[model samples]
Target: MRLLLENKQFRIFWIAGVFSDLALITYFTVHGWLALQVSDSAFWVGATSGAGGLSLTMFSVFGGVLVDRFGRRSLVLVGLLIRFVIALALVALIMTENIALWHVLLAAFGEGLAVSFLMPAMMALTLDVAGRGKLLSATAARFAGMTVAGIIAPLAAGSIVNSAGIEWAYVMIALGFSASAGFMLILRPPNPAKRTNSSPLEDLKQGVTYVIRTPQIRMLIAMIFITEAFGWAHESMLPVMARDVLHVGATGLGYLLAAGSAGATVTTVIISNMGDIRNKSNMLVGGCIGFGFFLVLFAWSQWLLLSLAFLAGAYAAVIVYETTINTLLQTSVPDELRGRVLSFQAMMWGVTGLAGFHTGAIASAVGAPVAIAIGGGVVILNSLRIARHRSQLDPDLAQSSLDSESIDSRGDQPES
Candidate 1:
């Protein structure tokens, strides 16, 4: 904790990140509920959610390039500024009672675009500030913040919506975004490394090639894509499922979502306290399998109590896998290359989520249970295959390779 306090920039960044994320969660939860109220169709709600994913899929590559070229601080400021303007526009529209479904869709898409840039830039900044020795702690701190926001934002938004109106929820989110922008404006991060003449396209290609050539990173990325496509996609459908199948209202769904957040918070605290444990590779493998198993349990559950329990378990497993994989990436990759690599990872996640949303939509047409069950089964099968190849997929391989390269560099020098 003292170490974290020493990094003022990181604290500022964390504040900005948390507030922005709070706004985002509040907006999306309320927006989805409002869309359901307006159209009374699950398909449109899914499409609204998919629009955000599609924006991330399309723009993430460019966002990464901007981060590498212009530096993390500048890109973050720009992204937050854009979000501020977007939020203000949304607020104005709501205040005048002139909002429409298309208006909400456009706002969601714009926010998604901002996120494509903001996420990679923030990640790059975290690595720069925390450096190698504290990467795990830094990651744990960020995840803890997110978990807390996830718990608070949805429930708060639900209460506001129930008591006042959806417009009030939008106003609250706008205030959060505006405050986030203010905090971001005060942060001044370290300067990025200078580049000679590298084109953005070449940089993107290089990042992609590196990930492809790195066996562990490749396998990890593949696992994330597949796991998120199946197990994670169910998140967008939760509101609909709660309403239609479980016969629960918005507030109940919010409580269920909070349960997942509580689970994530607990796991993050455990990881933070444990520090770096041995057998991380084996732990990752086991966590992935556990994630899939709990997802299956969540899908098959009919009782609300059982579903919440399964979701909590699933959430914990995913958080562990995510934090471990991200720590490995940040510690292993060189500073100059971090932004581009993270961007690629973000892109993969976005595209997979887009596919998963469409799959969920199709499943809704048949039945929500059928869709979630199939998704869970596929994830379990894929995780099993990955577990069997644990030796090759171990994320520690990257760190070991970096150490070996350092040794080789030292050996090639003349005697002092």
Candidate 2:
């Protein structure tokens, strides 16, 4: 905490992250409810959510290019500003009672695009502020912030939507985004590496090539893609299950989702206090396997209490795995290439998540239980494959594969 407080840029960045994430979570919770109200069809709700993921998947590579070319701070500032404007437009549409399904879809897509850029830039900037020596703690702090927002937003949005209206919830999110953008505008971090003259496209290509050639990064990326595609589909399907299957209302669904967030928050806080753990590869593999198991249990649960418990456990495992993998990547990759690589990572997640969203829609049609069960099975199988190939998947292998220019020339050498 002291280390975090010592870095002015990092403090600013954390504040920005909190605000942006709060807005995002609030939007997602309220949007899901609004879609259900308007369409009265689970399939459409899934598709409405899927649309945003689809947009993010399509534009993530470009988001990476923008971050690498224009710089992390610039990309974040631009993305947040765009989000603020988009949010205001949404407010106008809602106030005029002129909103349609297409307008909602457009707003979701725009938010998705902003996220595609903002995520990678934020990761890169966090690394820049933390430096190599403190990467683990920094990553933990970022995840902790996200967990806090995730936990708070759903309950808050639910209350607002139930009492005031969905539009008020959206208005709250817009204000959050506006405040985040303001903080970002004032943030200026010292550049630790010299700038390059290469085009953004070239830089993006280089980043992708670097990941593809590195066995560890490639394996990790593959794992995340599979985990997101299969293990995390529950999020996309939860609302449908709560309403159609469990006979739960919006408030009940909010509480169910909040249970998972609470678990994730607890995990983040615990990890943050523990400092860095060794054998990060083991942590990644074990956490993912745990995540898959809990997902299976959650899918099969008939009792609400059982379902909530399983969801909470699964979410906590995901938080552990995600935070560990991100720290590994930050510590393993070169500072110069961090922006592009993080962007590529974000892109892979977006694409995989998009696939998951569609899969959820298909699953909802067939029966939520069967779909979730199949997804959980796939997650277990994929995680086992990664564990078996740990040697190839470990980020430490990047030490040998990365070219000189792939990392910052002056950054710390690989620890012997």
Candidate 3:
């Protein structure tokens, strides 16, 4: 917590992140609503979401390469600027009554492209500003910021859409992005990324090879993809579960989601204060298992209160798992490869988006509860399987073999 006040660079960056994240949350909320207006079909809503996810999937690696090659702060500012433009463009379309389905899709895709750059560069830059020592606390703080944004952004966007107009909602979004960029302009990293002569393709190849060959990284990436595909995918079916299974309407759905956010907030505060934990891998393992167990409980619970409690527990477990894994990965890698490595996590977001489609399909065949239970079952099984090789998840390798390997591969001096 002191890190926020003691470190000026990180303070600025964190504020910028909060604002940017708020805008992003608002965009997603507004994007769906606007999609419904332009085309009332659920299929079009899915397609609009898919457009963003597809863009993220296709361009994340290239964004990582750019992050490693250019100034990370500069990249973040650029990404924010692009998003600001996109938001204003939407405002114009909405105001002039010229908006179409294609316009919405294009804006979604553009936002995705902007995020591809924003996420990797911002991730790498976190270590740059905060240093590896405070990585976990800094990450927790960022998550806390996101949790705050998640709560506020939707409500604000919803209010604007209801009162003023959709165009005004977008106007608010544009203001948020511009405010973020303003904060970013003043941020200065402790160590700026050095320009590289390596081709983007070559850099991308090296990053892929490094993750594939490194056991710790390979295991972490695999776990993330599996969890996202099977476990997090169930999020798409929440509406169905609320209506059909729990007999809760839209208002109840909001409460259920709010419960998850509340749980995340509590966990984030605890982690932020913990400083550093030695056995992060053990925590990660436990978190994954807990996440699955809670999901199953939530699926089976007929009572809305019990389901909310279970959902909250699941979200808390995920916060633990994600914060631990992100800290481990950041501290493990050399500075040069950090962006590239973190991009893999960005890629997992894309997987979650795609997995929603499959999860929805399964829910169509079986009931939503059964489908979600199956997803949770898969998460538990995969976590157990990986738990057998605890050594690979160990952080000792981060200070020892992995550091040596990263240095040898990149020919960069180790961080002090």
Candidate 4:
């Protein structure tokens, strides 16, 4: 609250996130609905979503290198502009009635490529705009902004798809992307780390090595990968649950999605207000467990109201864990490594996408409920594994990794 009110640059950045995330959220909602409409198969729906994830996996590391060399602001601007173009293309396709599964798959892949650059830069820029001391609040506030988008985007996109047509929904997405880019045009965060003479490949190698060797980062990345693969993968099956299981249409799906966003909005706002706190690891683990538990409940739910309640709980728990991890990772690393380290985090979305594809196939084989429940179960077991290895989450271990084999000129091993 104070941060947004006090920092002009961060305020602009936050506003841009709202519109950018709105575009993203709307695109996903509409994409799932459109995929279902065109193919009428769960496997194809997951494939479409997975295509984007594949793009993210392939290009995100490069995006990180670009961010370090070029600048975060420029990448963010370019990414949003690319998404705006993609949205326009989708609009044209839908309007011409030439929409097909391949078109959706291609669009999702393109969108993911753009986001690969946009997200790492955006998150790295947040630390610069708000300063290290305020990373948690800034991140939580940013999530809150996205939650606002989440609450509005689904309902609005759903209504547009139901009433005016899918083309109009895409028009809204394009406009949102453009609007976000416009807000970004005015933002001037601090410059990225001083460009070293090191080649981009060298920079990338250093970043990956740093994450691999640093115990906290290594473990955190692994933890998030598991969470994304198993827990978040359930997202692709959401439409299946909404339509086949819940027997709901587009409008009903909108409410179902919006319910989760509403829950996230509340959670993010509260976290934004709380400021940074200690024992973040405990909170992170607890949130992960809660997210899995709620997701399982949501999967098994037969009643719409019960499903909404569980979904909301799942989203709320996700916000806590996700925000905490973002804060932890941002605060743990130096400014120069920020973009690269965060890039690995962004790559997790790719895992989520690919995992969603598998989850969808599983859903087809067993059932949506069973598939989702299985994913949720995996998350529970993974988080429990982390809970037992508490020392891996310690910030001291990250500091030790940084200080010992510093990426500095000396490369001297600092004494423990």
Candidate 5:
């Protein structure tokens, strides 16, 4: 941890990551509520959420290919600048009463496009800075920021939206993006040793091929997609849960989300200090099962206090599962393909949005509890399959000849 802090570049990037997550969390919460208020239809809310993440489906492969071909820093700056501008634009449009569902949807599409590029670059750079030796700690530190931002952003956005209106939440979102971009300016990854002169299409093809050829990574990506699609996508139902089940207003919704994220934050801090452990595979599999059980229980609970307790447990298990997988991926993949692999990871968010669309449609027909319970069931089944293949889930690649391959898992190796 001290080594990570002593490295100036990644330290700045960590701060940048927190700021950007603040912007995104606030924007999503504010925009989701606005969509519901404007349309009064759960489907529209799902559509809007789907639209935001769906934009990534169009751009992530290209973004991933480009980041590896060129570099990370400049791409990150441009992406954040565009996001900041879009946030400011939304604030202006909303304040002027010129906003409509289409306008908001347009803004959302723009946000997704920017994020598809930004996140891959930022994560790849993080791995670059931390090197192979510190991958576990560094990845934990990065997500520690995520858990904190989750804790704070929802409650803050909820309060602002309830008091000052949604536009002010957006305004703060813009400021967060600007601050994040400013911190990014100080980051400088070590220069590449060679250039790839191949066309973008060829490079993209190579990346895809590499992922397919690697069994463990392929399995990992599959789990990431399934879990995101069914597990965490339940946020699409939160507004309805607040209105129908909990009878909590938006403020109460904020508190409920904060409770869940607070649990995740505490869990992240606790595990970040665990140093190294050998049972990561079992924990990864077991955590997903635990997340499923807790989620179903939370959905069934009609009491707010009881529901909150279950939600907290659900998020704790989720963080445990997600963090272990992500850390293992970072340590396992070679640096040359890191950007592309991470971008594919980013694509899971899009899958969640699409799955949320279906989940919402199901909820509209069957109710939130039924839809969430089905999702939990699916998460359990899919994660069980992953556990069945737990031998391939090893992060150190101890059983593979590729472990002996001359691959620089760390992008930067500046000499003393």
Candidate 6:
């Protein structure tokens, strides 16, 4: 922790990310709620989120090529500024009583598309500042920071919405993004170690090809997409679940979110203290299985308190699964290809939106609880498939492959 503070670059990078994440969380919290208000349908709410995810997905590869071709700082700045401006516009629309569902969709699309650049640059830049030796610890610290932020953000957002109205929540989102852009403008993060000189289209093709040819990356991505497609719609499902399934109001929804973050925060602190993990693959598998199980439990529980506890445990498992996957990928991937590679990870997030719609449709047909249970079951199936690939990875490679990231100036032994 002291090392994170002592490393000026990591401190600035982490702080900037915290602000951006806070803004994003606040925005989405309000955004989904608003979508529900306007349409009164879970499917529409999911579709609203899907619009943004679609934008992010469509633009991620381009964002990657640009980040690798150009510099990180500039792209990060552009992305932040774009979102800040969108937030401001949203504020205007809300204030003038002119806000509509289309306005929400417009704002979502702009923020989502712009953020594709910011998210990859953020991760790639963190690796640059920390380098390989401190990368895992720094990444753990980063997640811990975000977890802390997540814990506070929902309760705070709930208060603002409860006392001042949802309009004020969007105002907070604007301020948070503005502050993030200001702080980012103060940092001196590194550029990619290897820059692409090819056409953007050709570079994108190569990035795709590279991910395919790398078995570890390929297998990991397959797992991620499966989880994403079946498992990642919980946020979109939250408002409906809170209102219909649990009879919890907005404030109750906020408490549930905070409870989940509390669990994630505890797990992150544990990981940060552990330093280099030896049984990371096992932890990753266990995390997925735990997450899936808890989600099913949460779905089945009728009592709000019990459901909240299960939800908290579910998020804790997700944090463990996600943090491990990120550390492994970042440590193992080449600095040159890092931007492009991380972009694919961003695409996993994009997949979540489409999955959100699928779940929402199910909820519309039946109910949110059943949809959530089905999603969890699907995740467990995918986890089993991910486990199957482990046998082919060689026990030594499975255990110590983290060291491969440091082998050369390139990175992670390039698949085969």
User: Which has the greatest TM-score?
Assistant: 4
The residue-by-residue lDDT of candidate 3 on 365-401, one tens digit each, is: 6767887788899999998998887667776634566
User: If scored against the real structure, what TM-score would every candidate get?
Assistant: 0.89, 0.90, 0.87, 0.94, 0.92, 0.93
State each model's CA lDDT, in order. 0.76, 0.77, 0.81, 0.88, 0.80, 0.81
Q: What order do you get sorting by lDDT, best first? A: 4, 3, 6, 5, 2, 1
- In model 3, state the lDDT of residue 367: 68
Q: Could you tell which candidate, 5 or 6, scores higher by TM-score?
A: 6
Residue 298 of model 3 has an lDDT of 94
Number of the predicted model whose lDDT against the real structure is largest: 4
In the predicted model 6, the residue pairs found to clash are: none
Model 2's lDDT to the true fold?
A: 0.77
TM-score of 4: 0.94
Give the per-residue lDDT digits (tens) of candidate 4, residues 37-137.
Answer: 99999988888889989999888888888877776888899999899999999899988999888999999899889988789999889988998889889
- In model 3, pairs of residues that clash are none
Residue-wise C-alpha lDDT for candidate 1, range 211-326, written one tens digit per residue? 88987777877887787777777776777777887777787677777778888888887776666664466666667777778877877677898888888888888888878778
Model 5 / residue 367 / CA error / Å: 1.3
**TM-score rank, highest first?**
4, 6, 5, 2, 1, 3
The residue-by-residue lDDT of candidate 5 on 44-142, one tens digit each, is 777777887789777888888877887688888899899889888888888899889998778778887887888788777776777766666677777
Query: Per-residue lDDT tens digits of candidate 6, residues 357-390?
Result: 7888998998889998998998987787777666
Cα miss at 401, model 5 (Å)? 15
Tell me each candidate's RMSD, in Å, in order: 5.0, 6.0, 6.6, 5.6, 6.9, 5.5
User: Which 10 consecutive residues of model 2 have the lowest summed lDDT?
Assistant: 395-404
